[model samples]
Target: MTHSTDSNQTLFERAKALIPGGVNSPVRAFRAVGGTPRFIQRAQGAYMWDANGRRYIDYIGSWGPMILGHGHPAVLEAVQKAALEGFSFGAPTEREVELAEEIIRHVPSMEMIRLVSSGTEAGMSAIRLARGATGRAKIIKFNGCYHGHADSLLVKAGSGLATFGHATSAGVPPEVVQHTLVLEYNDVAQLEEAFALHGKDVACVIMEPIAGNMNFVRAGVPFMRRARELCTQHGALLVIDEVMTGFRVALGGAQSLYAQQIPGFRPDLTVLGKVIGGGMPLAAFGGPRAIMEQLAPLGPVYQAGTLSGNPVATACGLATLREIARPGFYEALAARTRALTDGLTGAAQAAGVDFCADSEGGMFGFFLLPRLPQNYPEVLTTDGARFNRLFHGLLDGGVYIAPALYEAGFVSAAHSAQDVADTVALAREVFGKL
Candidate 1:
């Protein structure tokens, strides 16, 4: 309970000796921001305490999983009861079926689902299913839209449209990504060109409804509509990567929002994670029954995980889903998120600091640019030095957001009006200095 002010630094130093870069996750190292990552000891609704016992208003929300915020009473009870009953069964349970039913009920696009342990696993499995069902070898992705670290997906855009993407990661070789084509996000012309070139051989086109990793640039409505049309025309599956937006953005995820804009729109395969697991390690991908049945004993595409449906993770996810399903949950969460962004925008305007922001449901993003960015190249234009100052300023003032500029921030149901007000007030001060 008692620790020195430098406890976080001390722990980081010790961990560096044992763990690579002293972090299990790359961003957690704060490499982009150039600071020691806070060693979190514990978290409670809308707040987290670090190793030095410093309490900060948590806006990250465990990178968009804690929608109802950390340790809700109902979620805690479900998890505790499930834990008492058992952990992983290495088999099926009633609760797993119940959770699947719940998700399908809300996300109509997913007629069936296969649960996994993380977003990466869900995305990887979805691509495989697409390839298997369609009997196609090529896949298409957009720049800055992260599906996972899957080898084929770990690719960057080539210099020209004709060439496929090159491997972004070291271990991922050229041949691995040869079938992967990466195009500029929200660029309808380029998308059409790609489909025109490789339509017949394309298995699927995967994308985030809102590219959260690129700091929340929306996939333009025209762009999304074209994607759906092209995929259908080409006999390629449309995979919506809603790992960050599922349940966090709305009951049906970001796809629901897009469907409203483009009537009767739906993805062929949907990848879900984050809030679905309620801060636990659980994710899933699903589609029509015929496509889903293509896996395992039913079909040729083989994928398996020992901890696919861990009892505790499903229990936590089910509990979280039930809570967010409540009436007015998202309406209230959206208002809070808007408040945070609006306040930041007003503060930046008053201080003459170039800034803009956008939000959807509980998820939000901001940039130190005069206008909101629409693509990865535009996102790169954000002032990194200024952002680092603002990040540290907020952290010092006991408000924590994502350490990296390119990541989205989250607002939870647990965040009070006062919490948003405090954050805005602190941000105003920081903006003046900037």
Candidate 2:
């Protein structure tokens, strides 16, 4: 098969003249890796076809929402059927209520929830709800765990912000993030210190239970325990941001995974997206009734979206969730992800390359280092130049991973054993060259 990107190059050239950086999202520009960003024409199962009609095994999975893969029959059918019913009511819909019920049934922490159009909206609203409920101003967030592009969240944020190396975006004013204290991802000591200093003033402590933006770093068990205790002791809420991990990690989200490790563990609030939207523009944040009722009609913390809980999006999300909830679905997905990491690790070891990989459920990431990094600063130690080479070599071999090393990759239920084998074979070829 030819690895031609002719049509992709031409489309990108045209896009650059119109769109900023020739992409709607920053990482999609391929600026970090210094290449022509492939203009994806379509995607199905575990494969994507670029504008040049070249096919590549897709690992990005639309950045994580395509856990059932591009166009799963169930999700597509639901979406199509809902579209025919009507697009948007600008009023309440029963399907939205059903989606909420589905989410509440799985996540124990949330007694009430409000659906929004994007992860950023969900995160931003959750912060507002936290501040409003607690009647406090300050909020603590971990450095590498990106909640979204919200002003408070962008402070020392990870993912696209880290890839660009911006301490904070220029457009956001200094006063906006002043109350936002940015701490290290797994530093329990710093967590303790922050609460000790401003315990009374802090409204909440928000973090990704498993930081995906920094390439799959698990918040240390000790650190997680300390965070939960500190938040409770300080009279502050613990908000777990699972926008990337939610249903993708498991039916119950990363919080459930943590619950298994620590007894009776759950966050005061939760933010969700990605898989819940099933590739559509939908996301949500929820918590117990007392805190959640603080938003809208019941209380003063106001948040609203014109297209919140969109009919078609909810249908897609609901279908995807139901399918994944089937017995053995997560077990199979986990095994497939583990197989990919194990294969790559063995190949890298055989080729004498310093490499380490980690996975949980369908999400995974790798670094060209002897071991996985625990935080943003440590994650930075990965050899960027070498990662670029491996990325390009994989791309040439018809396998597509994220353009930047900081981003996490996803494996879909649609990925067969043969697909894993093909990905591993491609990686071995790249490792041999390295």
Candidate 3:
């Protein structure tokens, strides 16, 4: 099939004229891979068909929310049933309570949660609550860890250690991020030193337990332990941003995995999105009653959303969570993810291509290097030209991965053994050319 045919090209041309970069999300423009973005007409289990009637095995999984793949039966039914009842009440609903209870039940750290329309809102609210509860104005975030597009968090590390973060985006003022300290991922010593210098003023240390934006890197065990210990010692809240890994990594989330290694491990606050929404616009942040109670009506920190918990969104999220909670769901998904990564690595080796990959559950990332990158700087050393060739090659062979190298890829429960084999075969073909 000719992917760049008029069918998709025409739509993209129209879109670019109307929408910025011809896409709502920056990566969807395919600017990194250098191609016209596919205009998806429809999607099914593990597959998406573009406007040109070309089908590809979908590995992006809508970034992370489609863990059960597009059009899950249970989720679809629940959403439809909810739409019949109402769309948004702009008030409370029994379904909202049920959804909150479900999330709180799975993650013990969240004694209470407030739902929002997107991950950015959830993250921003969490930070505000942290500062208000602790009466501190500063926060520490890792370089590659993405909490959301919130202005204060949209920052990069400055030239020297202990320096305040600088705004990465154009519109964000430098003063906004003056109190935000950006550090390197998995650097225990650097983290400790930062805490030593500014611990008293810091309200929270926010991080993605498994960093997904820099393509699936994890904090070392020692680093994780030290951060938790220092946060407790400094009276700073440890906020785990699990928007991507929440239910996609495991049933209990990435926090549960950490609890296994660290005794009594739990974040003072947690940020959640993606899979919890099950492909809808829903996200949340919560913690023990004390900190959460700081948000409006109960205390000084104020946050509110007009459509906080839409009936349809709650129904979709609730149904998706219930399905994934079934016994052995994650085990099967993890096996499929492992098969994909291991197969691709083996094929790359046979083709004499320098490559490495890593995975947790359904989320995974690969790099064109001899060893996996441990931090943002190392992740940038990838061969961009070679990766572009591989990306287009796989795309032409009917496989869809993320358009950018720094973005993580996802596998879904809808994927089968045959799907894994086909993806590996396609990668081997692409590696041969590289």
Q: List model 1 lDDT by residue over 166-235, tens digit each.
A: 3276787789999999988999999899988999999999999998887789999999999999999999
For all candidates, the clash counts are 0, 0, 0
lDDT of each: 0.90, 0.92, 0.90
**Candidate 3 clashing pairs?**
none
Candidate 2 residues 299-344, lDDT tens each?
9999999999989999999998999999999999999999999999
What's the residue-level lDDT of 284 in candidate 3?
Answer: 96
Residue 126, candidate 1: Cα error in Å is 0.4
TM-score of 3: 0.97
Local lDDT at 395 for model 2: 95
lDDT of 1 at 212: 86
Q: Give candidate 1 regions above 4 Å deviation.
A: 157-167
Rate residue 363 of model 1 by lDDT: 94
Clashing pairs in 1: none
Give per-residue CA lDDT, model 3, range 1-434, as digits (tens): 66555788899999989998898977576877788999999999999999999999999998999999999999999999999998998989999999999999899999999999998899999999999999999999998777878889887521111011233767888899999999999999899999989999999999998888878788888888999999999999999999999999998899999999999999999999999999999999999999998989899999999989899999999999999999999999999999999999999999999999999989999999999888888877889789889999999999999887878899999999999999999899889989
Best by TM-score: 2
RMSD of 1: 3.1
Model 2 residue 351 CA deviation in Å: 0.9
Candidate numbers, best lDDT first, in rank order: 2, 3, 1
Which regions of candidate 3 deviate over 4 angstroms?
1-5, 157-167
Ranking according to TM-score, highest score first: 2, 1, 3
Question: Lowest-lDDT window of 10 residues in candidate 3?
Answer: 157-166
